[model samples]
Target: MGWLLLLAAGCSEIVFAVSLKFNDGFTKLWPSVVTGISGIGSFYLLMLAIRTLPLGTAYAVWTGMGAVGVAVIGVVWFKEPADWVRLASIMFIVVGIVGLKLTHAE
Candidate 1:
């Protein structure tokens, strides 16, 4: 349950981050609203997860997932670019997340 909440938080973060680009620095209405709602929901879930999971582990996974997710969003939806280096970096984040989960027994 904690892991699921953390993953959801991470996804919410990604959603807010992508919406931020469309927010036009808060000039837009709908995107801005989406960003605000997602940001709040992200933190709420993050807090829920951190209640049971170690703070460091929870935060690391949350941010790691969000980073990878946003980067993929950049490449896929925004066509930002995805060479080998970028792809490898994302894989590293995935490996790190796996490692953290494995090492954290609680």
Candidate 2:
């Protein structure tokens, strides 16, 4: 359940991040609204996840996965280049997340 909440937080983070591209520095209307709402939801879910999980573990997973997801979104949706180092770093983040989970006391 806590993991699910954490994933939800990460998803919200991705949404807000991608929306930032469309938000046009908060000049746009709809994208800015979406960004605001998703950002709030992301932090709320992050708080909930930390209720059951270690703060450091939950925060690392949330930010790490959010970063990886947004990078993928940038490549696939925005046609950004997927460099080798970027991909490798994403893999490292995945491994780190797994290690945190495995070593988590709860």
Candidate 3:
């Protein structure tokens, strides 16, 4: 349950990040609304997750998920660089997230 909450939080974080780009520095209307909603949703879900999960582990996984997700979105949706180095770095973040999940007890 905690992991599921964290995953939802991460996805919300990804949406929050991507919406920031479209928000035009909060000058836009709909995008800004989306950003605000998703940002709050992410934090709320993460808070719920941390109730049962280790705080350090939950925070690290949350951030790692956001970073990797945004990077992938940048590459695919924005047509940003897909160079080997960038891809490898994203993979490393993923590995770390997975490692934290697997190693976590209770």
Which candidate should be chosen as best, given lDDT against the real structure?
3
1-106 per-residue lDDT for model 2 (tens digits): 8999999999999999999989999999999999999999999999999999989999999998899899898989988888999889889998998898899886
lDDT for 56 in candidate 2 is 91
Q: Write the per-residue lDDT of candidate 3 for residues 68-104, one digit (tens) a residue.
A: 9999999999999999999999999999999999999
Note the Cα lDDT for every prediction shown.
0.95, 0.94, 0.98
Q: What's the lDDT for residue 19 in model 2?
A: 96
Per-model tally of clashing residue pairs? 0, 0, 0
Q: Which parts of model 3 are misplaced by more than 4 Å?
A: none
lDDT score of model 2?
0.94
Q: lDDT per residue, candidate 1, 23-98, as tens digits?
A: 9999999999999999999999999999999999999999999999999989998898899999999999999999
The TM-score values for the models, in the order shown, are 0.96, 0.94, 0.98
Which segments of candidate 2 are over 4 A away from where they belong? none
Model 1 residue 17 lDDT? 89
CA lDDT, candidate 2, residue 44: 100
